[model samples]
Target: MPTGVALREVRAQLFGAADRVLRRDGPSGLTSRAVTAEAGCAKGVLHRHFADFDAFLAEFVLDRVERMDEQAATLRESAGTGTVADNLTDALIAVFGSVAVAIVALVTFRDELRARLRETWPAGVPVLTEAVVMIKDYLDAERGLNRVSGDPEGLAPTLIGSAHLLFADRTGTPPDRAAVHAMVTTVLGGQA
Candidate 1:
């Protein structure tokens, strides 16, 4: 909010504020005014940067998706270095954290935001698709190291699907590290 703050810094601040509002108060609490207030900026800051609230929301979701994709991509670095279940549990935990859960919930409940996202990304925001790809790529890397036996094509979706369920159940207690490890182990046919 300070004068001369870089545009990227302002945008990151706004996005963080929006993410906090979404996580604490759900989609209804995510508005330009609320975001600006939370970010300690003038109310017009969001409007100045984005065409509209929907546009801001779309960009926020896309940013989070890119972050999740990056996290998933790191699995390649850990391949064969630890127990497969442990490595996967760490990745899934990163993917299903509070901020990601909030963004998913926000996009799901807000029709206007969803529609705006579809306008920009006709194939839909590539969060899940990209996650699946990253997971498969990691699994393939592990396979090459002889740490995982099965085809990643079959395994990635099953793991991701279950992770989705675990992530979607916001009303329930979130899964812990042990649970995530168990789920990954099960999906890998007890390879862990």
Candidate 2:
């Protein structure tokens, strides 16, 4: 790119580039240089916007988490309208559809990124943590409607952890949707 050309939506463009790097190359391949290269922007563009790579990564995770909040709202609205297992299952698929799993791996390997995230999150991985809370909140809504019975607090982590495992690694494809549905059903079978 040019030295003086303005980059519109620079953060988003860089974030999209980083996400692709994380997905394609995994954490090992994700670096400021790679991201800038992938983004077709000068390396200085990234440094100019964010203090460091870790700061950019933390902001990226925060942006994704903010997006997850939209999905959470949608899921909560779905509490009484569908089979509990299916609703939960579909939500899992959506949340795990791409970035969350890779983000977990990235956070695990990057000590500085984790530390920066902890300043605000102070508890868990951003997407995963939001996922757990999303599930728990949805389950709570279902319980209130008597559509589901059991402890949402106890079940949320169980469900999210299981779902996370299903999406974590790949065999060229995500776990079969039916299999995931079955897993959710079995978990909630006693409750519903």
Candidate 3:
């Protein structure tokens, strides 16, 4: 039990270090040595916790996505009977904000690492699946009271994909949240 507890602690430390590295300097800043240095441990500590840098990066991305998923789940529960636009806007902001962009970069630019990561760890997919299901559930519930036009299951991915792209590009031009909300309102036919 003590060993398990210690391992969990070490994993948390590794994840936290990864978060700091990614947030401060983006994916380029992530290195096993850098993580160990931030974690105040020897380099071998990461190897013990993760298979390699790819595994570490995958866990880090998934950890952030899980955090975002939890937040969105809570918002979904609390915001009962809210307009789809409002709910989607809140959820998108919660799930796919600037920090999410950094995560996407971490996963996208490092393909070899990402492939290794995917072979061992399926990052971000489950959370996205849950989001889609939740949105579909919400739309199904609201169909009678709301004027939902398109299929929520299909629209959910499209909406999320758009946010993903916008985040990836980092255009720094459009008012992203508002524009996203507008798009959701138009595409999903819900009150914005």
Candidate 4:
């Protein structure tokens, strides 16, 4: 929104502001005006860059998915370096943060945003799917190193499902790092 900032920068700035608002005030607080104000930009900036509020939300959700995918891709690097539970907890925290929960609430209540997202991602955004693949890949790598046993393909979904439950409980206190580690340990058959 600042002078000389590139389009990509503006987009990133807007998304960052939106994420902050969503984290602080939940989905209901996210609006073009709120995002612009948080980003320190004029209100027209969002409309000029995106077709409508739904379009902007769709783009925001897609951008977050892409970022999660990127983070998942890096899981293999941690395969043998730390406890599997620790590694998994790190990845899960990255993918299932407060912001993600807020986004889910937003899309669930907003038909236009949900429709726009489905138009782009018919398989429902692929966050869990991408995360499963990454977890499986990391598990496979660990299995090869003789650090873990069992079918990663089976465990990945279980872990993802548990993480979804943990993250979706926004009304309660979030699971702490110890709880995350414990869940990952249970999934890994005490390998942690």
Candidate 2 global Cα RMSD:
1.3
Quality of model 1 by C-alpha lDDT: 0.80
Q: lDDT for each of the candidates?
A: 0.80, 0.89, 0.67, 0.81
For model 1, the run of ten residues with the poorest summed lDDT: 1-10
Candidate 1's displacement at residue 141, Å, is: 0.7
lDDT of 1 by residue, 1-192 (tens): 554334558779998999888877777788888898788877777888899888898998888777765576578888979788888898878877647666767877889888888876676434666667778999999999988999999898788779878777765788888888888988898976
Clashes of each: 0, 0, 0, 0
**lDDT ranking from best to worst?**
2, 4, 1, 3
TM-score of 4: 0.85
On the 0 to 100 scale, the lDDT of residue 167 in model 2 is 85
Error at 88, model 1, angstroms: 0.4
Which digits, one per residue and each the tens of the lDDT, describe model 3 over residues 1-192?
A: 012233348888888887777777777888888887787777887887687788777777667656755665665564446566877777776666546666667766788666865675565553455556656666655554544656767777777776665555543553467777876776665543
For candidate 4, the 10 contiguous residues with the lowest summed lDDT are 1-10
Strongest candidate by TM-score: 2
Question: Please, what is the TM-score per model?
Answer: 0.87, 0.95, 0.75, 0.85
- What is the alpha-carbon lDDT of model 2 when measured against the actual structure? 0.89
Question: What lDDT does model 4 reach?
Answer: 0.81
